[model samples]
Target: MILHVANPIYDSVFKYIMSDERISKTILSALLKKEVVKVEMRPHEYVNTTRDTLSMFRIDFAATVREKDAEGEGFKDRVILIELQKTWLDTETLRFRQYLGAQYSNKINIRKDSPKGFAYPMVAVYLLGHRVGDIEEPVVYVNHDVFDYNGEVVEEGKEDPFVESLTHNSIIVQIPRLKGRVNNRLEKVLSVFDQSRKDAEDKQVLNIDENKYEDDADMMYMLHRLTAAAADSEMRQDMNVEDEYYKAIEDRDTAIMNRDKELKHKDEQLQQKSEQLQQKSEQLQQKSEQLQQKSEQLQQKSEQLQQKSEQLQQKSEQLQQKSEQLQQKSEQLQQKSEQLQQKSEQLNNIVKSLYSKGMNILQIAEITGINKDEVAAILN
Candidate 1:
């Protein structure tokens, strides 16, 4: 038959459920697979009653375990410190460290063998209300094993005081992932924290099949405890308060996320603008360099033109001087021509007189040094 019980996801309900010594021992034994000889609640166990924000619901225990001897001859008793925490958010790394540091620093986390107490091995169990990264497993066990330089395991399951006290082991139970998975006794014990079993109509209550867990006495005891919690008026009221608190926290986180997204968008836009401005500055610098080159070329062309102009001026001056010399030569030639004309005229007159007096054409040609035909033609 399906039975109604208080949802153990609530801090108040979870505290109530784990408060039982039998349940705690049963759970520890199932998870660690060790025979728990004794269970003692540590002083640090508490439920944060503040409704301001969602916080870790943590509990600590010191368990005496009965285990086989190293020689496999007999049994031995060992005391180990266990820290169990339940959290709804994934952002608990710093908080987990701080809590763990406190446990390590605690003076009572020691076993009494010598005059001074020796440190006990530490075990951390986290009941995460949310999923961890991409791991889909319901239970994750993290243990430390010593290895030699040859890449071989030193001691497979043997516990050493020096190593155990200094280092620790951890078990993380993702409660959200415990859906339809009851293959082991540990998973079955952890089914109490499964959110899927919660009643569809009500968030505070869960419907479980009693017949399935009827064979297990410890499991039946746990269901009875949760059933009592469901009837308790005060526990029910506390569950409601927790619901409101978680709602407020979710709303606040959403707002912060939205604000961060807006800031990221603005930052991206500013980055793009900065890149564009840089490109424009480079283009302007290139244009300035090109203009400088063009100015230099123009200066060179102007210098060449000036040299050509000066050469042309020199040639013009030389031409002018040659023209003056040619004009003078022409004037000298004209004067000489005039002198020759006068002499010719005088010779012609003399020739006429000599011809008229006694000389003939031969004498006239000899005197003038002209041909006889030319002298006759000149006279005619």
Candidate 2:
């Protein structure tokens, strides 16, 4: 039967074997029967006998048996070598042989001259998990002394005839075959190690009181610790993922804020340009109005200058007509002066006649005297 024991060191097969002490005691008690009182357990230890040796080996557990008295059917003192096997290594058989030899030679103290030969037999038991197939029964091999020649078996026992008859006991228990073999408390304990069962069923099997003893509390505590550690590790991984997610969101928000600020700056620049354009348009409108007013004033000034020029031209024509009339009047006055000179001449001739007809000298003198003097002067 296979039983699990709690192993804090987590050695693969040993951890499975050491999962529960009650299970361990039950299996060990059944194997050794009445000879075994308890099992001696220790952490796996490695010793280097040689400085240059790089090899290592471990002893899983040693059994302590009670001494037997001579009542013809009592318990015998003995020690069993227990091994938990998980992997199907090719060298396992040789390694198990080596372990048996070490246990036999290294553990027991011997005297060179003592007559009592070592009577305690070292048995090796392997509790295998899942590898051994089809063979439902436990495989048992007993080592015996045999004759060999050139690495070939020649005879049954020629070298050590005395001890050859007794069999060296070894047992290999395959865990896969325990499906329907045995019932009661032992089978329930074995169900926990069977991977074929559902997890809930396995938990139910572990909770069964008939399968466990009061001494299994320590194993339960160790299992709880392992479960808690696994849970904490998972929680830490989840937290790390959450932190990365939050950091990505923060980076995205920062990028969006920068883009918004850039857009706002561009909008402000556009607004300023629009305002400048409006101001320029207003200035152009004002200039256009001023130009229109100046054009109107220039048109009025041109009309006033044209009227003044027309008045000055009319005054010049009137002055030219008056100058022509003055020239004609002067010509007429010259003609009148010529006629008056002729009349004076005629008056002078008349006076000369009066003087020749012998008129009175005093009358002629009074009437024509002044005229005669003028007429004489003209004749001269």
Candidate 3:
């Protein structure tokens, strides 16, 4: 027969184990280095409140502890808040601080002799499936410190650190770092988280030596709880729900990253297109300037042609005036020629008359002042 304990890396299983008053005291007592005599579970173990846009639903086990002395007698009862964390996530870091702050908000009356208000001592036992903060140890203890500019302890030295400072206290149990190695009772108890199922057949029992833990009843009890939890169908369903919840968160984050990447790519393409358009616009501007220069040159040539045409029109007007003056001179000469021809015709007629009156041709030519041959011809 195989002995198994449900992996405490699962919050549900961790919660189950921590909820047991006896088991939780054993674990907390080992972690706090105090002998827990009696433990009473406090009310409102889990707060489902929301803060800062985050669901403040945290699995908490508030334990009131009565420590045992060497005489096996109980001492003054102490309040310690044991928080079971399966995994530490980045978003939940702030939430974790908020949770611790919430714990500090409450005042517990511990002693009738002492003051009426005090906060509970908190011990955060993290059954981490992964490592954090480059811490190589399987178990790392963190204590709140009051330091100055230098790394010097300024708090009053007290015999008990947890009692002196309730604010600065935490214990981290990194189960993956353990790697199935057990050195102490605490490690033995935490070993259940380190165990894996025997096969992919989903068997509840772990194939480990039960004899090694037969002397340890707490380990045995834990093994029984893990086996029972594994066998439980309803519990498995609840675990499945938790798995899906975490998966959905991862899926949502991945989707956002992919969407941002796609948008960045689109922005790059748009920028390239804008640059291309700007280049084209610059080219068009250059072409337009060239066309304007050509038009200016053509306009200058047209103005030169217009000036030449005006000069030619003035020369044509001057030639027309000269041609009119020549016509007037020619008309005066024609009138003079007509008057001479009339005088000559009159003389010729007189010559003929003289000849007819028995006068000689020479006397007729002298009277007309005409040539004698011309008068003879006229007489004949």
Among the numbered candidates, top TM-score falls to: 1
TM-score of each: 0.69, 0.37, 0.60
Sort order, TM-score high to low: 1, 3, 2
1-380 per-residue lDDT for model 3 (tens digits)? 55544445455665676678777777777777776766665665434321112222345666666665435664676666666545534444765675566666655423233453444556766555566778877888887766668888765553253454355567877755777778876777666666443434543234556788888787677677777777777777766766666666667668657866875686566556556655655565555556555556666789876565555555555555554554555555455555665676677667756774668878887887778898865543
Question: Every model's Cα RMSD, please?
Answer: 45.4, 61.5, 47.2
- Candidate 1 vs candidate 3: the TM-score winner is 1
- How big is the RMSD of model 1? 45.4
lDDT of 1 by residue, 106-164 (tens): 88787677455558998999988888899988899999888888978887655667678
After superposing candidate 1 on the true structure, give the runs of residues whose Cα lies further than 4 Å from its correct spot.
45-53, 156-158, 268-380
Lowest lDDT sum, 10 consecutive residues, model 2, at 48-57
| Predictions in order: lDDT | 0.79, 0.46, 0.61
lDDT of 2 by residue, 1-380 (tens): 22332221223233334545543565555544434555766454332222111122244555666766456577676554454333222234664566556555553422233365533344556655445555755433445445456677655334232342133555565555664444544444344444343235222112222234345553355444434433454433533443454465556557657866875686566556556655655565555556555556656879875555455445544544444444445445444544654665566566655654555445565776564455444222
Question: How well does candidate 2 match the true structure in TM-score terms?
Answer: 0.37
Clashes of each: 0, 8, 2
